[model samples]
Target: MKRILVVGVTGSGKSTLARALSNRLGLTYHEMDALYFDGPGWSVNSELVDDVSRLTAGSGWIIDSLGSPEVRDLLWDRADTVIWLDYPKRVVMPRVLRRSVRRTVTREVLFGGNRETWTGWLSREHPAWWSWSQHGTRRREVAHRTRDPRFAPLDTLRFGHPRDTEAWLSSL
Candidate 1:
């Protein structure tokens, strides 16, 4: 549990759980979204790969997400344990939608100071859309990938219920 990769569909509480685990276990907490996005207007940062490479070069860390495939291998290759928050799609979908709307309406600044806008929320390229669209695929993809022999070095914990996850996390 020293070097962990917290994975799940958006709004499945990846960031929240990662933060808590890091604090409780005294491990470094890295939010991958901060590595990929830059200041206001939500522009994509080119240094994402470099940032992730540097951050994970250490012996221990807990990262929130690996939304990009390029960085996925980097984290997956090094992680000792993976915590998969496999919450129901219906549960996550509503949470993501509500969070997106709240952020857009309140103009909350996120990673690298970027804030979500009403226009972006309506657009097909929005994070909300990405979350919803990627939901099903990610659920299946991560499940299958963890079972492959290539991932033998890693120990994965899949949680279909939040209570089960909490119990595991608490036992440390």
Candidate 2:
């Protein structure tokens, strides 16, 4: 699988799976979060278009984040594979919460030099909130997009739950 794009609702383990795939396949791992969120004030990836171009210009690479809808064609047109980690809320919510708590407790530095905080976790903008609110919509959107005639040439792999991800990854 070359030129892969990993997509899912926020905190659905897209980045994690993409990273593993990159390592296993020996492809360049592009953390779109690092590109989009790597700003001075948590900006919305001001350089998204240019950065995406630069990253995808190569023949092989794995992108962990979906970036923006504005660049969907840029990615889908070039990507040979698109992996969707569409886990259910029951499985994803606790994972997101645990990840949030771990990041907050660790004071981990994320993209844009941002650190997870209790306040941020409680805020509406948090990834957890986004995951909860967008779970169903995101699943439907991904399914529809994958089924679209425009993307018919792309190979889509969807994992409905965490076990599916592990099984697939392990097999690889």
Candidate 3:
């Protein structure tokens, strides 16, 4: 599990797990969002491909999020293992809602120094609604993608519940 990819819908704990796994395994942790969003604005990072390419050239790394399709193609082919946080919407929505509220209320700056606004939730672009709207479709898409023959060489560890992920982390 040297080169690991942690993937999930927003707020599904991919970043948390990726950080933990990187710490436990002593691998370089690369938060993809940091590479995808790098300033005080919403523009996509143009250096994303170069950043990912540089990381993949190394022998070990653990990254969070399935990046843009271009990056995903490059990442998935090189990653040795993929940890999928497949928690259900029932379990995920509240967590996302709480996180969204906390980040908004606290004005926590995220990737690109972006802060969530309560009024922002009125749109589907908000993390809460994005997670809510994308959860099912994201689940199906990732599941099907991983099943392809091209990805057969990649190891997959999927967690449907928090406890399952906790146990796996503990085991590691």
Candidate 4:
């Protein structure tokens, strides 16, 4: 299970699971957001592809994203295993809401040193909003990607509920 990709829609706990798996498996953990966002104001990393390519070239890694569009295909091509958190909106909405609220309330710093703000919630890009709006689309995308012939060499584990994922993690 080396070179793993933890994939899910916004607020689906991709980072948390990927980090835990990395720790358990003693693999290098790479937070995709950290790699894509470079500084304050959510500045983007212009060299994202180069950075991701370099890291994926390594023998072992667990990245907590499907990858942004620019590097998505590269990630899927290199990954030996993919863990898909395919939880429905009912499960993810509350998780995302709570997470966004807590982060906004605490002014917690995130990737690129950006913090979620009350006003940010109004934006479509906000995690809460994104999770709600893109829930179905993201699910379909993941489903299609998993079935794609180009990625047939990859082993996939798809979990439909938090409990199932938790049980599997514990078993691991």
Candidate 5:
């Protein structure tokens, strides 16, 4: 599908799946975090909306998020297909924990040239903490949006587990 959005709770592999889909479908791939986070210190891009709007105006692309608050509606409105990774907290928590730990241990650079630090894990904004705290909320939000009339024209592919998603991907 063209103009795709990959949505899920943090660490649900949205980026991974979106990348694979983009490659397989030959569509341009856009990482939402890379678009929103500009430089070091996790600084935000002031032109996020404009940038997102310009990208979405194109005829084909795949983005790895529902978009930040300011551009969420625009993303949903323009998207033709939405792939929702709806794994349970049991599946997601360990993933997020391992990912954050690896990033911290390896000093892996991320969006905005930021790296996860041990001290940063203490904050509620940390990926592990955010994923654990917002898991249910994210699921509910995606669920509601999938059924919302405003996005009725959208086609949704919701996977409840990793294996299911993998099998579907392999098929494609």
Candidate 6:
């Protein structure tokens, strides 16, 4: 509950949980999307590593994104607990699809001045695509990491359903 790393497939409620965790624990909230995506005409910054390093260097904070292994390791190495939102694909897919549609239709500004577009939603590079493709693999990856001796010392909280996740967070 001190310093947490909230990981999940897109639309699995990572941001929401991170926000609530921040408020409940009185910690800082760091949205990784904002750090990774640059303003207007969305582009990945070369300085993303430096920014992520700076953000995770603090003592008390919650990160809502899972970056590269090197960057993620840096955060997890320092974090006291790791919360993985492992909701079922059927539960997550619809949420992601609806969210994508809403963002595309409304042209909502996110992560700087960047907005999600309908074309991007159709593209394989979109978060929705990543979510769909990585659903099973990501869970295996997290499971392996949790089982590895290197990560064994890290506290792990995994939720197979959103309601269970809510209950766990409520108890925190």
TM-score of each predicted structure versus truth: 0.92, 0.93, 0.95, 0.98, 0.98, 0.92
Clashes of each: 0, 0, 0, 0, 0, 0
Residues 1-172 of candidate 2: C-alpha lDDT, one tens digit per residue: 7899999888888888888998899999988878777665587777788889988999999997554786778888788899988788888899898998899999998888888888887778798898898888888888888888887688989888889899999999
- For candidate 6, which ten residues in a row score worst on lDDT? 65-74
Q: After superposition, how far is residue 74 of candidate 5 from its true place, in Å?
A: 0.5
| Candidate closer to the true structure by lDDT (higher is better), 2 or 3 | 3
After the best TM-score superposition of candidate 3, give how far the Cα of residue 170 lies from its true spot, in angstroms.
0.5
Alpha-carbon RMSD, each predicted model: 1.5, 1.4, 1.1, 0.7, 0.8, 1.5
Model 5 regions more than 4 Å off: none
lDDT of 3 by residue, 1-172 (tens): 8999999999899888988988899999999888888877566888889989998889999999776787987888898898999999888888888998999899999889888887788987788888988988888888987897887788999999999999989997
Q: Which regions of candidate 3 are displaced past 4 Å?
A: none
- For candidate 1, the TM-score is 0.92
> How many Å off is the CA of 69 in candidate 4?
0.5
Error of 5 at 122 (Å): 0.4
Write model 4 residue lDDT over 1-172, tens digit each, in one string.
Answer: 9999999999899999998998899999999999999998889999999999999999999999878999999999999999999998998999999999999999999998899999999999999999999988888888899999999889999999999999999998
- The models' CA-based lDDT, in order, is 0.84, 0.85, 0.87, 0.94, 0.94, 0.82
Among residues 3 or more apart in sequence or in different chains, the pairs in candidate 2 whose N, CA or C atoms overlap within 3 Å are none
lDDT of 3: 0.87
Q: What would the TM-score be for candidate 2 when compared with the true structure?
A: 0.93
For residue 70, model 6's alpha carbon misses the true position, in angstroms, by 4.9
Candidate 6, after superposition: displacement of residue 126 in Å? 1.7
What is the C-alpha lDDT profile of model 6 across 1-172, one tens digit per residue?
6778888888899999999989888999988888777776777767887887887788789988555664777776777788999888899999998998899899888886987897797778687898999888888877787776765577888888999998987887
lDDT per residue (tens digit) for residues 1-172 in model 1:
7889999988898999999998898999988888777766666778877888888899889998745777888888878888999988777878888898899888888988877888787787686788788888998888887886777778998899788889987887
